[model samples]
Target: MNTLEQRYQFISLLGQGGMGKVYLAEDTKLSRKKWAIKEIPLTGMQRKQVISEVEILTKLNHQHLPRIVDYYTDEQQQHIYVVMDYIEGTTLQEVLKQKGVMDWKDTLHYSLQICDVFIYLHHDLAEPIIYRDLKPSNIMITKQNEVKLIDFGIARSYNQEKQDDTIKLGTIGFAAPEQFLDGQSDHRTDLYTLGSLIYFAISGKRYDQHATTPLHHVAKVPQELSSIVQKLTKHDAGERYQSAAEVKHALYKLLNKHDNNKKEQSITPMNIGTVMISVIATHKGMGSTHTAMMVAHHLNKKGYKVALIEANKSNEFKYIEEDYDGKQHKEVQTSCFSMHGVTYYKCEPTIEIATVIRLQYDFIILDIGCDLNQAWMGEFRRSQLRLVVGSAATWKKQKILDFVQQYEKEETKDWVYCIPFAESDQMLEIKSELRSKRMYAVPSNPYPMKLQEKTIAVFDEVLDHLPLNQKKKRLSIWWLLVPTSLVLAGIYVMMIVRM
Candidate 1:
């Protein structure tokens, strides 16, 4: 008997079924690479069917699909083996058995990954391939938290003109009703199985074939997700999503809405460390609002909780806000709003507002306009970062130069950062000239500020150097009492307004 010992070192038996025994093996030539080899006793007739399936597997190139490496028969020709990429993780069925049920977020994430794999199989392929056996046992959750589809033993190409599959295929619980009725198994068949699979993963309960309300008994499932799963599992293929792409889009929408709602609900006051940034204009006609807006927009896009406040006496960002939809926050008096996932406030940097905002946001950028008086300068001096922004034009450069020279002599000069706004072509020259000073220059960015890695790196360098407050303020009983009372008063006011 010739075993696989010549080319591959067998590690252990992975699993066995009626079809074959799978072994964890490592290639002798590529010792570091591991593979799963399925050994099946095949007669002469069985070889032809397996060859056709192997051709399809050999051509598959997807991140989530297992890659077939090689196939060989021993000297006796009684058994043949199929070698494939070893997915190092438990099956979804095993995960559910051990963990009971998964959180909706986790279930949704896994489901979306599975949907992406199906999208490739059904749409991206030359001929749409139907994964007839769609079940948790066939889906591997890798150690790296990636979902890998395995066991394409019964997968077949879908011919749109055909009326039905040649054979009935799929697991009993997860299979669509059409699969048993001699009806065609298409994209919708996979969607049906996916819905049942998701329901099982989330609820920790087996999907009941007779149950009309699959997700109804699972209370923790979000209403939005419930609606999607219900539609996907509809017995009638016409009622379900037409393609895997459609299911993915629907799930993505729910995820986005869930994230936005999570952000909205987290307005409670806490002792979170926050950095207050002051973007002060060194000269008139300098783009202070522009600088503040751009910086805040970038930070927010970088996953930081940022709020841009118009603290200048003149409403410099007025035009910008008016152009916005102006429906973020309904409190007309506060003029506080959210746009482009960043919050903006049209209010002076008063002590009370500043203190409250410091608790709510990671970064609060104050657009203090062009007026640098004693009171304004005093407030700017206290900030963790105070930037003097101005134009780089010859006339404007004089004011910036004078301001930098005078600023160097100040006690809080280390906190001062200079940013000269120049045309896109002059950024390199401006940066080189101001290299000696702790200064930054702006490159021309597209309007509305789309997120860019390079732009984020620049902002990251600026933020990383800004010193964090290390001294925790010891609070007296009165210190806590005041905020507690304020919270109660605010709650009362909200209740009264509702009445």
Candidate 2:
């Protein structure tokens, strides 16, 4: 077999069934799109069955159904390759097993929808079809709670003129009686299996839910549908529903009755905010660390509880300098949080990102060196942001700008915000350059502790771009404390308030 892992970028193996294995793989030929690749080992009649199912599913264009996108045999190896839409969501079997059944209304609602799916598949197809296998695992629910019937591997088109065109294949306990005896099946065979399916659904377990109950004390099937249930399980092939449509209509009617007693399915949307990831990239001598630290520090002081992640390994100790000429400590009333100048470096930039993100910080700004395609840099680009910071040199700015533009053309959401450094007499020219590049310009001045008016305004602009859902409150500003009479007096006032 052609190991798909050798060629295409492959995600994890999703499932391994009796027929084959399904993998979530990336199709580079399809513009690096995602596809669910199924590798089936064909034997005797199985190859024919796989080919026919692929042909049928390709023609199927239902929104709820998964469509087959590509099909080709790997002649070098000897297996058939089938690629289809990789639908998201857990299986119905998983939901039932995990949630431990459900309320009568929920169960009825699920069964009712499954019936509708059968109706759509049978009546809507060019030629009516019969899904020989109807089991919980085969039916999947989307993230939106929309029902989807999957695994068309065993489905076959119905024959009107021919009488005995049945096949001997289906799940054992869930199969109709005639299917076990012989291939004496038709659309009615599907209906019988569906009835068994509903029986399992209503009972809130497998068909054998009440298997251990005493035979004399077993719950009785209703008089109206007792014969219908018996016909489904009848040893004789002659005794069953005429078609899948009949069974579907019956289940839908029950569904309406169930809905009349209570409300139907309700799906609520989750709250998604504007959380983005950005990497700060620059040359080795460009002072990218200082720029990144200043940006994070400015945003944090302006009424936002921001998180500063140290993405570089070299400057972890230098940035957190223990001695800073008594300037790191300053006074500001609006800065309600720890106003000791900076949160400093905490994120130890390692190859292992899973360990890095555990220390939660709001804005994860990665300070990157000139190295573009390193392992961790690639991982950072895959993040929500990839920022390139350049210095006063035009070539440096141009190189970084070209990188951002190329990335932006490929992905619109990825953005590159530029910041130029100017500590000399060329401050006015630096501002002009920033405006030309359509970027935010910063004045080379004393750090934020001086609480300058211009620096504070710039902080507000960064705050606007920050995550808006942050909850704000007065912060405990005692991270660094020197005992004094003032502290005692403050405690006294707090004690009186408690009283």
Candidate 3:
């Protein structure tokens, strides 16, 4: 075929299957943009099936799924052409062939990504979709290490009325037993395939049902990961993980366990002191104070002596004290208070951070607000971890870019960019542009004083590699009152009063 719809120019054939052919084509109508054109021959009855597939593909909007741009039927060619994003990457199968076997950590990373896609397909959609085929060949790993599920030819919507699949379709090794037994496949079927895929990814061996071999026997996989894989590959669908979310949670737990072990092993005697976290924002109203409070409370709950210091001249902490004390009058002044096991210090402009560091808190969270001026830059630079909270909105995105550009000269490995209320796609785009995985989406927390699971999870990932101070000591009430005297004594203070 020379060209289809007088727009897409065929460049080269990408691949061919029993269904049809996929070509790497360029859209002449859209500035010569590259796209994958799928040409599937259609019979009279098969046209309806192709139409249903097109409907499902076009409606999907996900970061891990390919976008379907256009579809058309060429009656003379007797084929339906579907246009989609040209994914530039190597298949997982090719990677396995080149490397022989993958590291267990890499396998777990890709598995978690696949679980995210599965969760979106199974639970996030209006009608659940069960991916009937899942194998290394079907999974694509981008240059940036992002996982993308390429083909959806055999994917079908879940139907409670049907007891069995009308058409049984799946690969031999990766397909669950139910797929070939005339039994209906559900979300659990995909989980089973994920198990098989994980096994092959780590060991470079196909999973066999008849002569079952434990993953640990073939590969040096972690015990937790092996247990999760075993549970996922159970012969009975009921015995397997019920949903992709469950599998994801299990994988995350395993990852955390591995990370905690590494942290413990890497800890040294010199690094066992107090760790400071500085929280700042690109601009005002970007949730710096809220993010600091959330982290402080979370660390406090984890049995750390967490002190939230107002490192900037913001009234956020003073307001928080007033609100907590049930005093509506603005005349009430409390420079220091303790709530929820976290000590809050409302520092004055002359308060010195060195003095606070001498107090020996396990974790000192400096809420610097949006003040990136030289006055607060010293404290921000001294912190072990620096969190820059910024808006993810399109108009406000430039603020974050500007902030990064200003600090480009400094070492940024300790810096983390946080966008509040950011969607998955937004976070992915920003992360790609920034070329940093330290970026995280801060979940919405209406009550910063209370701990939320989602928010805590973000912090868990952020602080996973950091060594925690094992020497835990409770904060005394006298230590809280010391900040009040320091502020009144006209010493350097980082006065933080709530908005």
What are the per-residue Cα lDDT tens digits for candidate 1 across 1-499? 2347477778889887656788888777553457799887767786766666676766775656776657887777787788887887899889888899888888877887788788878987788788877788888986546688988866788888989887676788888888889689998998898988888778775675324665746648678788888888888999999998798778867876776687743222233356778888877667777777778887777566777877776764545554553223332322454556566777545434434352246788888877777776776787778777766676566676676667666753454444544664454554455554455655555464564565556566666665432122324666888999999999999999999
- Per-residue lDDT tens digits of candidate 3, residues 450-473? 868888888888877566542222
Clashing pairs in 2: 277-385
Per-model clash counts, in order, read: 0, 1, 16
lDDT of 3 at 342: 74
In terms of TM-score, which candidate is strongest?
3
Ranking by TM-score: 3, 1, 2
Backbone clashes counted, model 1? 0
List candidate 1 stretches off by more than 4 Å. 41-45, 75-78, 264-499
RMSD of each: 18.5, 18.8, 21.1
lDDT of 2 by residue, 1-499 (tens): 3345344457779888877888888765445656688777767766676687677766665435666655777764457778776777888788878776444445544554565556656776677777778777887876445566777656778777665544567787677665656454566666666656555654555573222432113333333343445555554556666655565455445545444556753221111121334545655665556556665666555443344445555643343442231113432111011223333433333233432232223444555545455665665656565454565554565554455555554453444444544444443454454443334445554463444576556545544444544433222233223356579889999999999
- Residue 407 lDDT, candidate 2, scale 0-100: 55
Better of 2 and 3 by lDDT: 3
